[model samples]
Target: MDSEFENQCLEQEENEEYEETESSSVQEKNNDGETTKQLSPREVNTIFNSETEVCEYYRQYGLQNGSGIMIRNTRKIDGVNTYLTVACHRYGEPNQKVVDSLKPKPVVKTNCKARVCAKRMDEDNKWHVTQFDNKHDHDLSPSKAHRFRCNRKLTKHAKRSLNLYDEAGIPMNKSYNALVVEHGGHKNMPFSKKDCENYMREIRKLRLAKGDAVALQNYFNKAQSIDSHFYYSIDLDDENRIKNLFWADARCRATYKEFGDVVAFDTTYLTNKYDMPFAPFVGVNHHGQSILLGCGLVSNEDTITFVWLFRTWLTCMFGNPPNAIITDQDRAMQNAIEQVFPKARHRWCLWHIMKKIPEKLKGYKEYDSIKFQLQNVVYDSIDIDTFEIGWSSMISKFNLENNDWLNGLYEGRHRWIPCFVKDCFWAGMSTTQRSESMNAFFDGYVNAKTSLREFVEKYDNALKDKVEKEVNADTRSLSTTIPCVTPHAMEKQFQENYTNDKFKEFQKEIVNVKYCECMMLQSDEAIFNYQVEEIQYVGDSQTLRTVKYNVVFIKDMELEYEVKCECRLFEFRGIICRHIIKVLLFKQNVFTISSKYILKRWRKNVKRCHSRTKVTYSTWKDTEEKRMYEMVCDAFYRIVDLAAENLERCNHLVGTFKKLELEWDTNDKGCSTSIVTKPEYFVKILMVNVA
Candidate 1:
């Protein structure tokens, strides 16, 4: 019996040693592994089938450990979520509005090794956590995890407000603060700042300016829906990425008809994330305000891209090419303009032409004087022969014969010199270029990191402000008191016929009338020529430079007169020159100058002068009465178009309307003392009586 008991003890000792060795080896193999057994009966009954259900299971599982875990990666087969990897993250927690991408992800070096991957089985329509590595190197914190993990997901209302502010150009930080205040603070908020950032990125993507291709498609669709007259054309390369894009709004198209005669094209500034040069076709309005005619985005200012853009602009403006176009001295622009607008006088931007003078010539002696001389040669040169003589003499005097830059500039003189292109109408933009002002104007609208979507939106706002300014100027010109003018019929005619701003300009010339004198140089049956000279003396201080002008005039139908001047001020500035005004006064027409001499652009009736007035109403909210007033004005516009005929016909209609106005006033005056009724009743009764 004693021998059998000792043998049993030895057998039990051997079994214990074998069991301990097997357990240690099993643990050593599972550094990051979880249970390999089938789930318990309770867990098996709680198995998930769909992606939503499986995701819910992971959420619950994560919560049980006092930490929130999110889906770190997801995969699908045949467009169904068939697999997913989840992990616990510390920073992924949101005060509110956390994005899935911003959810904290686990790293290999971290103690939190919590992870679960689920896959759908083909044999059974069931989902299983095929791989779950639930081992951790650190302790889990529930309270801290609760701060990130949502007790409840974001509601639909909150999401709507989020998207609303996102589109309104509100910053994420401000939005988050507002949301935190509304949601009862960070501890109780549903998402974190990281979550909001992710949402913003998604918003950017939706605008189609982000990295997503699908989002770009959505942007075009939405833009068109908002502005039906909004037109956009895109050219893409083999990679299916945009190479060129052009767009124009209804207001731009309408403004172009009158102001598009001379356009300044500039594309030097980069105001987008894609580093694309933003090109704006800009023009000056009758109000002397800079107006946007159209805009484009191009990967490069190459000939090919420029060709597409110019063609697109023509298409937008109904193929009516501009009479004169100005742009910086970019070779690509030169090539494109020659092809697209073969007839349009292509002039190099004057600002860029002069900008290089300081950089290239400032190092020379008498830099300031040299710059002054150069500008005079460019701007003040009156005749081609005079410009040539001054240019040759200045070059020789400055010893710029060896300067390659001057040589290059001389070669391109026709493009930048005013005298060379004096015949071309530049619309008061001779001394101005598109670069300095364009860069300044766009700097307020966009920055280097602006996205494509943001740029498009900001452009409309900028354009809106410009148009509003123009409208206000027009209103002020028409409604405000007119400035007093000299009693001369010529000056008085100008004061009533021209806008207030233009009157100020004419006033300058009229004031200088006394500072000048004219004499008849020659006369003929067909024409009369005169020499006009300006003289100024300051009490023996210094005699100012004597300026002279040669003006020719002819009479047509007894009273009809025509004139041209050597100064070419009217040719370039789009206004009658002081020389021409001097000739008219010298010719003794003192009654009134021909209506043909008055430019319609400078006239107070420019808008009224044009018959068509189709208004593209803005989308801002307005009161009912204001909306009704706009609609009534719109109806009046239709009536004007219908009655668009000779001036006599329009005057006849106006006379008949005045008779009706008199009858209505007579009735209103008779009723003012007889009626004591509700305001609406009186309004209705008066209309009924008048009708």
Candidate 2:
């Protein structure tokens, strides 16, 4: 009977089943050469006598047997083939051959509950299927049935590299490309870019789950705890969430109080993950470098938020407002400044205002020509009358007289136009360029996707780098002498007095002084003054235009010279214009620049607290915290250096400190009130050093 089944399996492989052997009763033939009506019940029993025979019958009936069936168990009853359990495969194998990674992997799951159990009768010594079920309740899509992940494909090294790249703020696509290159190509790579993308996203999500705002709060709290001068505050919304924040360390506050005469408040930089706008109050140092005074984060640009942010900054600085403040032209910002800094000269950022002109007039017929005319109107105007006349002519020429935007700009020209605010102290900054540079300087440290904790940490790191750069500049300025490129005595004096960067600027104007020649156009005997004039080549008209100015020599205790120029170069910026230099050098026979003309703010020795910023303690507090911190740092390094030079100095210093401790601890109250005590572990360290 087995041989007959084998022959049938080979001959009818395609058809599965064509005939049944004579082990059962032969039934009468029916239509289409089929037989069934004449079969007795005993014939059915004989055909299913063995479980193996039943399996063969199912195979012939074309059942899905590839990994879909399972042999659950088997049992022999009284030394005879008794019973067996069968079930459909729970693990699908759609991509089994491809996912054979030689590492442990999860199998695809399925709800295939098709089961069969066969029993053997003791009398017949044969197995019969007692219970069977082949129908499955769930539908199986061939491709998507197996969707489990294979993490073993990423080796230990790959995972470490992935995390390292993530911490370094490398974007996901770049990290995946790196992995691909390391493995030769994408085809040879064990994992796909999707895996890297998913992994990095999961890590960032976990980091953010720690609460970005909470992280920032904790950092500021810990910092202020260590040093009370590290001022930080957070304004919470009605819902008790962080809405606005302001922070300034001891160094930042000191730098501000010194250079706070002219400041630029930048509120346009928005690159953080939470979309919080950065507001850095920046100032120009003596070296012509941008210095950060303090930073703020706001949830929005509305007047309410800006008001809160500025008030918080004032509170941090002990109510010290800057002399001249500049920012982008925003209505809310303007209102906020009016409310908080009523005494300050609030000016709009020239660059920000100029940047919008192109977009606003983009629909015009001749935009380039109009933009050129606008630049002349905004930048090159000599005085208020000149600026107003030039602006009127440009708008009328361009038929922009009816344009509301142009009219609005003309109305608010005093806030940005240098001619209108020339007498105001700006420290040579016409716009908020210092604040823009400040933003660009911090771009290297923080990114748009950085978390709050990372932002705080990176901000500190960036501040450290900035301070280090300034230190290097200070060292260079002190040790290296500025070389004179011209034979002018005034040039030599400036080189000796000003910083390298400031001297370079002075040289630019000095070299151009040769093209400009001034002559006494008129004389005033009463003031010992002369109306000197110079003719400059006008580029637009291709003509020599004569410009006039007056210079007076007076003795106010000592001999001093004063100048009034329509150029307003010295009035707008602190530096003397080339037109003034022409008269001072050629006609006046003044070799060295007048003492009254050279402002002390641009001196090379700006760090010296003599003529520059005075060392003042915070009026809000009694303690000299910044000075104390500096002294501690200086003393620590000196001690370390001295100890390295002489090992006995360590012991001597420790002994001296211990004696001081005795005096502090032995109070009338008999309590140790000192912040320090005799070291309990220093003896062991001393012994180690001795050995």
Candidate 3:
């Protein structure tokens, strides 16, 4: 019966298409190939195979005649539709009281007596039109007929395409435009951009029908069940609604133990549907890759919220706080960091501070010169004395001693200035760019329309991709080797120890050895001082520039050799500068880089504990196969443990396993090999043998 109904519907659609084509061809021939006449309703004698055909026919008729059709009445007998009455949208009279309340507002009803009535025949099970009226007392608008709700409809295929677009973060207008092009033009499209938006809104409503908070909690619960190491905390308001949320997976927590010395925290991204700020604690791994340590969603950016998020994340990491942290210059964030991480060095992102130069100093008469001098004083100064002198000189020259912004910047200079913060290890980072880059990584998986539930799911997918990338890097580091560019033993030592990324950075400094000239300046008992001049290119012009750096070498019998450069690159970023390399290799004749200089965090062979944890985005079948394989392995482990207790028992067990393997091979050749294709099939065989 269902097949027959579908076949009739298809046939009816084909016939309607043919009639529409014939009518258009007739109009082209009659009116100089322009201006088609509106279609009229079917006569009272017309018959339909089913009641569905009657309603669809009149709906299309109304669309062609620039009228809206609606079902006015329906009669059923024995739980089956027997009679139907369809009418024009303006068939009823407007109520006087309602009309008066909405005075001057145009009413759609005009008491037009246009309708069609159909009755089902008891013998043939067909519908016959008993009454039809084509006359109307209202004006018609054929050009705007498609605007009617009854005339516009989206196919299942189109709805699916729109859903894909929405998931991929494409705008509704762009999705609609793409469909318009696919259909040849806007006029050929059955629905408008507004219709597409309405559909997407309905889709979001359906997705969040169970409430956002409940959906988020359910997702967190599922994640925890899959991985026992998954940690999550939610802060609720008095109404029991989630106000803040934080989560860190097993891998993230494990990674924090290795590279948690310098963390970049930022909250500039707020693209979710709830308007909550997305705060990601980002760190740099051995490969110089940005790794997520933890993430949070907060309803407010106040100190209390930040403190709560920080304490929660810290507890997840077993109360091990980072040695140093980087963030934007937010007063609330500073206060929170002081309270939660009192001993950790807090530095503001230099990029964020320097980015405000144009806004804060643009009003000066010599804005361009002032900006240049300010940047020079902030970046080029090598020590506190030099920075202070340059800052004072610049302020005096610009007559900006009274400037409040400059004074404020100077007061907080230690938080952002490079020279002031160079004593701590930063893992080659000085800004919140790591956190921003992490946010950019999520763009492909989420967007502003993403809900809390969707965000969590997509976040997992993104993190899984990140872990795969890290694994690929680890594989490359283990399998491949980059040849040293120089003949220096230190270069080769670094190449052999560091990952490809860090090796490249070391190579940059080592390769610059030729551009540096070292001269021994002074020497004291077991101490040597040297001045190194380096040739460099500056700005877009690539003009040759010469910069001189001081290097001091101390030879200690107990602690090996120690070399320090005034550039402070090694102290700040853990990368040995060219000056130190020149002073050691060229003058002091130190043949190899000391073990102290080779940071373990950048080593290639260190086995990270996080690599053992499985990511949470595997397919269901893969997960099941893995689980079954582990169970089988565990069973064999027990058998092997008992067998290994005595030599005689081990020998007997080995002999029996060899015999069983031969029997299984013989059975495989006799029966179909497909039977043993799945892990469960092999597990069943093992279970039978054990029983």
User: Which is the leading candidate under lDDT?
Assistant: 3
Candidate 3, number of clashes: 0
**Model 1 weakest 10-residue run by lDDT:** 20-29
TM-score of 3: 0.73
TM-score of each: 0.64, 0.63, 0.73
Mark the regions of model 1 whose C-alpha exceeds 4 Å error after superposition.
1-198, 209-214, 225-228, 430-434, 535-544, 586-591, 608-691
lDDT of each: 0.70, 0.68, 0.82
Model 2 Cα lDDT, one tens digit per residue, 1-691: 9999998877665342323232335455533587664221222233265777655443322121222345666887667657776655552333445455677476544656556667777687676767666555444222221221321156655776786665454667888888889988764566667777776667555544566566667667667766667888888877767787788887778777667788888877765777887778888777777777888878899999989888888888779998888888899989999999989998988888778877899999999999889887777776788887888788788899788887888889888788888878788875736656776788767877775655665676677677777778777877898788789889988888887777878887888777775656556542445455666676767887766655554434445656656667776677887777777777767788777677787887655431233222222222354345445545555556656667577776667657655665575346654332333233333334433
Query: Per-residue alpha-carbon lDDT of model 1 for 114-150, expressed as tens digits?
Result: 6666777778878777666655445554334445544
Q: What is the TM-score ranking, best to worst?
A: 3, 1, 2
Q: At residue 226, give the lDDT of candidate 2.
A: 63
